[model samples]
Structure formats: C-alpha cells, structure tokens
Target: MTTKIRMTTPLVEMDGDEMTRIIWKMLKQTLIEPYVDLRTEYYDLGLEHRNETNDEVTVAAAHATRRLGVAVKCATVTPNAQRVEEYKLKEMWKSPNGTIRAILDGTVFRVPILVDCIEPFVRTWKKPITLARHAYGDIYRDVEMYIPGKGRAELVFTDGKGGETRLVVHDFEGSGVLLGMHNLDESIANFARACFRFALDMRQDLWFSTKDTISKKYDHRFKDIFAEIFESEYREKFEASRIEYFYTLIDDAVARAVRSEGGFIWACKNYDGDVMSDMVASAFGSLAMMSSVLVSPDGKYEYEAAHGTVTRHYYEHLKGNPTSTNPMATLFAWTGALRKRGELDGLADLAAFADRLERSSLRTIEEGVMTRDLGILSTHPSKKIVGSEEFLREIRLRLEKSGEAGRSCR
Candidate 1:
C-alpha cells in the first residue's frame, strides 16, 4: 500500500448529528484516511453530547479552532421544542454554529461548487458568486415584545456620561408587536475588513448592498463603515488589484446579480445574508452544492456545509435502508479544511492531496456517477445514481487513480 500524507498540526474536528455524522465517518475512511495521516482534536457537537455537556463542547471546539487556526465542522441539530422532546434534553441548546461564530467573530463566505453537468438555473450565471455574510448582530440578535394592548413604545439610550437620548418607536392603537435590533461599530468595521480582504484575496470585485435610503440610520451605518474602510484602507489595494468595489441598494443589487455573469463577492447584513444565501445557493444549484467557510478577523477558519443534518435520511438509514444522500458539501468541507491546514503548515503534498481529492470528487460527478439529489439535477447523458457510500467510493477510485504521492504514516 502507498503511504499517507502527514500533518504538522491537528485540525479541530467537530462531529455532528444524523445522516451527516454517518457520512462524515465515511468521508474520512474512504476518501481521506487512505491518503492522509489524519490528525484531529475531535469534539462531539452532536445533539445528545451537546445536551450532556450543556453545549460547552461547542465553545471548546471554537477555542481550539482559534488556537489551531483551522477546523472542519459537520452539520449539527439546533433543537426546537420537538427536538428537545425527541432528544429528551434538559433545555433547548443554542446553535453550535452560532456559538462558534460568536467565539471566533467570523464572517461566513459561501460559494457554490460548480460542475460541468449541473449548470446554474440562472442563465447569466456562468461563474460562481461568493456570499460574504456578516455573521454578527442584526435581527439574529434582536429583542422583541408582544404588545397586549394599546400603549406607547420608545427607543431610549443612556450614554456613558449619564445623558439621555430618546426616540418614539410607535404609539400602538391596540395589540401589536415590536422588534429592536442593533450592531456595534466595532463589529461592523471587522465585517467590512473581512469582506474587503476576502475580495482582494480572490481578486474579485466586491458588491455591498443595503436598503440605506429606506433604512436611513441603521442600514446606512453599514454602508458608511464599508465605504469608510474602502476609501481609507483598501482603495489603493483594490485599484492595484484592478478590481472594483460597488455599492447599490439591495433591490438593485438583486436585479444586477441576475442580469450579470456571476463572479464577485456580495457583502450582506446578518438577516439579508441568511435569506439571500439560500436564494443564491438554490439559484446556482442545490444547497448541498454550496461550500461555507467562517473566517475570523484574526485569520482563523472553520469550514462547514451550508446544509443541515439530513434527519429524514437518518431515519431511513436507521431502518437499515440504503440511502443515496449527496455528500459533495460535506466532502468539500474536509478538503477545504485540509487545503487550509496544509497551507498554514507548509505541507505541499498534503495540500496537493486535498486539491486532488476535490478534483476527483467533481470529476466523478461530471462523469455521471453521483448521489440521488445530484442525479436528478444532472443533465449528463450517462448519469447513474448511487448510494451515499457508493458515491464516495466512486470518488475514491478516481482519487487513487490520479496517483497522488504521499509518505507512509506507518
């Protein structure tokens, strides 16, 4: 047997739940362990374990990523009321991804894994569009109140100097609802820098959108920060890279995105990002085809799939049925982590192996061997749907055939 590639530092591996957890193992065993001397600081972020540890494991994993510089995570269940009963948890745990994002203070960048057989639904989209989502404060951290009867509501702030500022929110006629949302200036600055740096790194034009005219103060603040940072910090750098930085209203941006050939980074606020990311993923292909990476301001990275744990698929598997679940996003998550790890540790062979594995996986699909989700979307003339494990095995066959050179771990 040929040797496996080595790693200088261990990756923080966050295990997940449901069908994705099952596929995570299959990935390492079939596609990765065979080629690399896999080393990871494993943390079980699975629902049951999160329940047991009170989700402290998620926090530890995020800290580990900060220390180690890279991590690969699987999709975990963020329990609702139904899930709390199903898992029989003490309390509903917060989202593991959310915990990690807060600790790392990162921006999530999601890009579609394009393929020859599966073209984007949008006819003008010939290239992949990257979504640089600000992963902090907005509606996600909102405060709300359900007004039971007619009353006045106001926005009040007490400054550090003990001075008062106030604004009338609304005077309710009867029953109504109210929401308050905010973002910090520091966080906004960090988000802008992350987006600008990512755009420069990819050498792609950066497009930022917000309903500034409508939002006035709130959304305009985001626009101002991005513009301020761009003019003072990134203008020359962007000009040197020969890339443009454009800002438009959200509505106009959407129209431009649909009409233009896609190849740029779109910076969005928390809520807009959450909604538009799904829209972008669906337009390009399946959400399962999107690859997401959370990049911290300090350069820490956590790569994960944008999809959720396939609960329905897990139920089928529990019944001992062979299911054809797509593993592209999960597979790419590992490859993304590996490639980043190798780059940081100066392991060219390890990095090359990651690159090889990704090409092989994509090649397998292009050649018509894929899981059911992709098979349905694939327009390839000779497409064949395979079970989850078989889909990976097919990619493994290609990876080995590519003659990736690695040193023996034994």
Candidate 2:
C-alpha cells in the first residue's frame, strides 16, 4: 500500500500447523505487515501447543473471536486416534472449528477463488458459487449405534416437565444401524438469517436444498426455517433487490448445479454442506484455492482456508525439497478477516488493502504465474510454476503494483 492502514480494533488470530503454518508467517511478513499496522490477539493453536494447554487455548481463542468480532485462522489439525499416536497428545481433541461454531452459533460459507487462467473442472461453470453450510449441529453431533438383531429404536425427548415424547426411529427385524440427530429451532433460525444476510451482502441469488420429501419431520424443519425467515424478514429486501430465494430437493439441486452456469449462493444443511463443499472445491479447483468463513447472525466473522495443512508438502519440506504448495486460500483468509475488520471499523484504507491483496493474488495467477498445483491445472502453455515461498514473492510483487494503483486513485 502507498500508506499504512490504521485500525481501530484488533482481530483474533488463531495460528495453526504444518506447511500452511509456514506459509502463514510469510503471508503476513510479505503481504500484510508491510502496509498495515495489524493489531491481533494471537493464540498458538499448533498441535503441540493445543496438547500442552489441554486445548483450553482453543476454547480461549474461540471466546476471543466472539469478543473481537473478527478472526483470521490458519488450518489446524483435529487429531484422531492415529494423530494422537503420532503427536503424543493428551486426547484426540475436538475440532477447533466445531467448538468455535458452537460458541458463535455460526454458518460456514465456502467460496472458490476464481481466476481466468484456469477453467473450472465442471465445464458449465461460468461464475462463482458460494456454499453456506449450517455447521452448528447435525450428524456431527448425532447419537449413533449399531442395532443388535430384532430390536426397537425410539427417539426419546423429555421436556423436563415430567412429560416425555417418543418417536419410533426403527423397529429392526434384524441387525442394522441406527442414528438420531437433533437441531435446535434457535440455531436453525440463526443459520437462516446468516445465509440470507450473506446472500444480500454478496449480491447473489440464494438456493437451499434438503431431502424434505424423504425426511418430513427432521429435514423438513430446515426447509421450513429458511422459508419462514425469508418470508418474515428478508422477502421484501430480496424482492427489492430483484434476487430470488429458491428451494429444491437435494437431488435436483445436484443435477441443476452440474448443468447450470454457477453464480449463486447454495445453502445446505450440516451433512450436505460437508459433502457438497468438497465436491464444489474439487469441481472449481484445488481445495487450497477455496476461501471459507464462519459468520454469526449478529455479524461476527472468522475466516479460514477451506483446505487442510498440506501434510504431504510439509513432509517434502522437511526433506529440504522446495515444495510447490498452494497458499491462495490462506492468503484469502487473512484478506477476508482484514476486510471485515475494515468494513466494521470504518477503515476504508485497510479494506482497500485487503481488496488490493486479493486482486494481486488473482492477477499473479492471471498473468501465468502460479504454484505447481494450479499451474498444472491452468490452460496457459507457459505458466511460470514456482515453489511456495517464491509464489508468495510473485504475489507480493503484484500487490506492490496494486498499491501503486491505489495510490494513483487516491
């Protein structure tokens, strides 16, 4: 930037692990700190530190996000039994994302980072598609069990007023599987509002899908919630904007998405979002090029990459090889956080810097310079493929050029 950006509020910064972690520091050093006096409440969310703090640090970081109202996070590991053995942890810790989403009552939105040089895997896609997932509850928090042969499975709900209601989930004739999941009306309402508001902010049409025909009571509730919120609160605004809120069956949505030119907001429930977001990422580009954020109904934002820590690249790095790891999503995460902070705090310069950073990153790729992953996917005959650090350097140069444009416009 031509001049440093002044910020009124500090952002919650949750750092993470592996190759992305290495890229995180370079992103700030090369792109952010040079032009912005960034103020952040830093929490080391690296796997070892998480184990050391017994994951209290993760909880504290989530709380910090609520307090700060804007957060930028790196991709972190949610350990399993295998990871527990590898890292020597106290316990296989819960996903920091799950914890943060619960605490914030947020909706996760995934948007692909688009570039002209590379075509989407799906030939029909002509624009970007943003997927908003109701991340709070669903199968992620479900109660599941394998049915012993010839057993009855009933969902029991007690109102705490000495009244109980039971719904027969299954009356098994033989050995089978059973699962029960519950979502609160409050959370559903919050998710609806977040998705609708995000559609408004993004200026895109909103499409929500569920298997309500097959799941009248369970899945239908989500469809009902979105319609109720839209009709009650957002219907007028949506009409005024000349944008429509469309609902369809999940199967139909998939088929429509496959054939149609993509440019809209797709609202999905917990499990559908999990599956579709991955499909959407791969269909658009590498997961490393997708940007994700969690937005609370009240407008708190936490930005993160849609992908993992690039464990393979980290291993290669350990062997002293110059790994061509992609860092687009992580860079976008920082920019997203910065832009939210700027917008909320009335710091246009900071917001402009965020814009410039994004444009520069895109420009770098558009100019036929990119990391190997994207370079290989790109149609450019002579794309300059560079290693992770060198790729950041290329984007940094583009960002300086972006700064010049900002200076001239001012």
Candidate 3:
C-alpha cells in the first residue's frame, strides 16, 4: 500500500532577499517539497525584481494571497536611503509588508522562537506569547502641529451627516506637544475582529491593553469598542473554546506579561505593538528566530520571517565566506502559512505535515544541532559552529533519520 499526497489549496510564495532568501530556496527544496505535493504560485519579490516591476509585483502578490487565502513570504528589503544608494534603486520604494497590509487591512502577529536551552530575557516566559498589532491609524499615521501661541487645541471630529467637536486641550500656555489623530470605526472594528479571530484560531486567551484611563475619550473608545464587540460576538466563542478576553491598563499589562508564564495572544495598539514586539524578540532570543504573520480580518494570511536583511553577513556571503545564517524563521514561515492553509481547506494531513516540520526544527535545536547563534548558547560552549549549508544539511539528515528510525514513535 502507498500513501497518497494531495493539496486542497494553493499557497502563494513571495520570494525575498539577503541571507534568509538563500535559506528560503533551500528550505523548499529540502523540507517542503519532499513531503507535500504543494501547488505554489511563485512571485519573485526580490528588491531588483520589485524595482523592475515598479513594485506592482508586491501588489499582485497580496491580491493572490487574498484569493488563495494563504501566502508564505521571505524577508525582503524595506529599502531606505542607505539601501537606495546600495542597490541603486530607481525610487525609495515602500515596504512590501506595508503595501500588503494596506491591501489586506490586516494585523501583524509576531511570536518568538522558544528553545529550552536559550533562556528568555523575561525568565517567566516558558511558552511563546504572540503579539497581534493593529497595524493601522494610530501614531503611525497622525497629524500634528506645534502650538507656538497660547490659543487652544481641539480635536474636531466631523461625520458626513453632522459635526461634533471636542476641545482636546485648552490654554496651551507653554511650548509643549500638540497632535490630532484618530482611528476610523471601520478600521478599529476590523482590528477587534482580527484579534478575536486570532485568539480563537490559537486557542489562547486574548489580552488587550490601553492608556484608556488617561486618554479617556480617545483611547477609552477603543477599549469600549473592543469590550462591546467581545461581549456581543466573541464572548460565547471564547468561553466555548475555554479561552478568555482580558482588558487592562498598559502599564499593568506590561507588568503582568513580565511576571506571568507565556502562551496568550496580546492584542496591542499600533505603537505598543511596535515597541513590545522588539522587547518580545529580544527576550526570546535572536531576531533571526522570530516568525511573523500578517492576518487580515477576513481570514486571508501571509507569513514571513520577522527580522531584517542581515546586510553585515550578506557582504561576507557575497565574498564566498561561509556564514552561519539561521533559517529557522524562514522555515517556520512556510510551515505556519501551510498550517493555516490546511486549516482553511480542512486538510488535516497537510496541517500534520507542518506540525511535524516545526517539531523537527525545534528538536534539532534542542539536540545541540544548530547554527552559530544558538550554538553559542549551548551549555557545553565547545560545540562546533556550522555554516549555513552544513547546518541545513544536518537538519535534513536528522529529520530524515528520525522518520526512518521512528524515533518519535516511541
């Protein structure tokens, strides 16, 4: 008897740049292709290709993801001034992620790589705590002006039907900060829905935090909206799933997060997500190990490596030097997206394959077979550091051998 392999849905693949890009190709060749019969729609989204296509490639990729319901992406360059000069880019293009998020209107969830040997900065985090950031219309997109004269500062909100105004501040006596910004009810509603969806998907408790006490009317509105939505829509599902929705002050949430053991979904405002993600990344380990997923409110998804292009190491690799680049995050991008795709299509075998791959990667690390980043943290520091090719080859060998010997069977 022979086992049959099948794919219920296609996965959109956006290839990217630098060290992880190299890892991306290697991963598909080794781990994914060998196990599953994947129907992948490939788009070369490397910087050069992006420039050649005038960044239309990214837009198309996002559309494909929306249609297909799942996308696995490599970490691409969000080119800045330095990158513009280095790559001789025609224009300083926007981040591919930003472009995709705008199209999908999604929230980005970042979760760290938790290895037993690599101790987290926040010692209490035994499990990975996922952070879902509402990636729209807050500090990221704000209108501000400095008040030179002592007049007044008002946040005048106007609707199409009528206008209602609120004096955000009055008597600006001293030279201080003044800003006017707002979130649309539509956007906030989508964000709340995404958070609820993510928590339900992960079967984890959802935590929301805000400075609602201080920003009573503004931030409080967000709090109230989330609460209302949760109560009206998500309460029953959350309870049924044996998960909970928690709201708290930002400071208190931070304190609780540090003290408590991990394994919860933290729904954050834009600014908080940006800041806390870095903290979470650092606590977990190196940025190279973090996995990120952009999940739209409508259930469309794109998963990717969370770190930037390792330019420093890329230069060495360009010189034909053996670099110990970690491919774990990139690998997870494929697995995570595929797992979601499986769930979406009700393909249990495909989902199980992803689970197996994830376990294999983690087991490889736990067994002291890792790249330089993780090898450095080994209890026996004398462990040999492996190059990119060597490390991946070793991982492949281990995965294959484990399957053959049925090591995990017992």
Strongest candidate by TM-score: 1
Each candidate's number of clashing pairs is 0, 0, 0
The C-alpha RMSD in Å for every predicted model, in order, reads: 4.0, 3.3, 4.1
* Runs off by more than 4 Å, candidate 1: 173-176, 403-410
Error of 1 at 59 (Å): 1.4
lDDT of 3 by residue, 1-410 (tens): 33645797789999999877887877888787777887989999999999999999999999999899999998899898998998899998887877787788879999997775677777687889898888777755566677777777776767888977675666787777777666777777899998998899899999999999899977898898999999999999999999999999989999999998999988888778878887888778877788898888777889988887777788898998888888888888988988988888889988887887787777677666678887766553335578777777777777665564322211
- Report the lDDT of model 2 for residue 146: 84
lDDT of 2 by residue, 90-121 (tens): 89888878778878888999988888778898
> Is 2 or 3 the stronger prediction by TM-score?
2
Show pairs that collide, candidate 2. Answer: none
TM-score of each: 0.94, 0.92, 0.84
Name the lDDT value of residue 124 in candidate 3.
Answer: 84
Q: Please give the ranking of all candidate structures by lDDT, highest first, separated by commas.
A: 1, 2, 3
Model 2 misplacement above 4 A: 1-3, 144-153, 168-178, 403-410
What are the per-residue Cα lDDT tens digits for candidate 1 across 1-410?
88779998999999999999999999889998877899999999999999889888999999999999999999999899999999999997877887788788879999999988887889999999999998887766678889999899999999999999999999999999999988889888999999999899999999999999999999999999999999999999999999999899999999999998999999999778878888899899898899999999899999999999999999999999999988999998999999999999999998999899998888888878888888888888878899999999999888878765432211
